[model samples]
Target: MYDDRERDTGTGRLITGLTWTLLLFALWLWGRGLTGVPHGTDGPATGDLFALTPAQAARLPRPAEPLGSALPQRVDIPQLGVQAPVVSRGLDARGAVDPPPFDQPGVVGWYGAGTAPGAKGAALLVGHVDTVTRPAVFYKLSTLKPGNTVRVVRSDGRVAQFTIDDVSVLPRAGFDARQAYGPRRAGRAELRLITCGGTFDRASSSYTANVVVSAYLTGTTR
Candidate 1:
């Protein structure tokens, strides 16, 4: 007779592990898809979808506003060897930032629903560390340290440089989203680099925590 109890237990474990592996793999593939997009791009392409929740869709910043003019065009961090194009898109229902094209994976964009770049507030730039297939831009972002520099190239050809003053990892659950994306004091411009880090959980399809790099503007072409 077959030992049904033992057989079921083994099958359950296998299914659990396979589920996590597949979840992790799917996340990786999504990251790689961004790299497949063509480089030196200037506008949205066909099949390039940008979907947002009703709230996000309604909250899109108006270009006519002064704060809207502060939106960034590109982000460059020589210290970390990063120079990615910037985009502007609203957030999803989950509050997570939208993903970029796979071919133009060098792109990073402003979380439109959050703070605007170059504003007297926390400017957030989110990127993928690695898809299931390969590492993505900002993959080495955690390597940045205090005093390192991050530059932002504006649409008007001006450039703003920021100095890294701190880097910290916050638990996924403990992430203070509002504070991280809130307004800043006068004369202060902050930047935050976000990515997944810590332990990886296949079942949950996420990392244990997020790696965040905080910086402040020091110089600019203004």
Candidate 2:
């Protein structure tokens, strides 16, 4: 018999072990599906897709110039009422970018080896959607829409403000890491907030898809 507990554990592990090497490889094979990441047993089903509608795209603020490199201290998403401390994390032996510990569900993990938030390249931030018994830091990530704001407080005492421009619930079958993680424009300071999305499959014990929220630096303040 399939147990819900197993499903929860599987989802947690699959997301925690998201590989960075394989994901970055998608940059060259932009049109090809991603590999190495675990997939659910269910058929192809992309979860709720939140993108920039024509009107929203027309209203998005201009991208701000990339800031000098600085460590991130916290991330704030006012729309979702999320204000969480950010911690630096590195890849594990298997090349997977380690996420925050399951016990630290309120914390966010930044890929330390990648571009810092507000820098020229796309910065990656990952968090758990939910722990076994409760919601996690990025639980409401998919609910964010284009034009919403994301504020990242940095060690340099500047608040880097980003504007959400795209949100996608990419299914596992053809997961495209390039689209999910790469910067949308050259030289732009970008950010990606990732979490598990879609239904959890008992057979595979993992969520069928991932929710990736794309945002870019648009403003800043102290």
Question: On residues 56-80, what C-alpha lDDT tens digit does candidate 2 reach at each position?
Answer: 7988999999998899999999999
For candidate 1, report its TM-score. Answer: 0.63
What is the per-residue lDDT of model 1 for residues 55-146, given as tens digits with 9 covering 90 to 100? 75345322111232355788888977778888875544343346664454467756654445555556677776666556678677666766
Candidate 1: regions farther than 4 A off: 1-68, 93-95, 101-104, 183-187
Query: Please, what is the whole-model Cα lDDT of each candidate in the order they appear?
Result: 0.56, 0.76
In order of appearance, the predictions have TM-scores of: 0.63, 0.80
Clashes (candidate 1): 13
True lDDT of residue 40, candidate 2: 30
The superposed Cα distance between candidate 1 and the true structure at residue 77, in angstroms, equals 1.0
Output the worst ten-in-a-row residue range by lDDT, candidate 2: 27-36
Off by over 4 Å in 2: 1-48
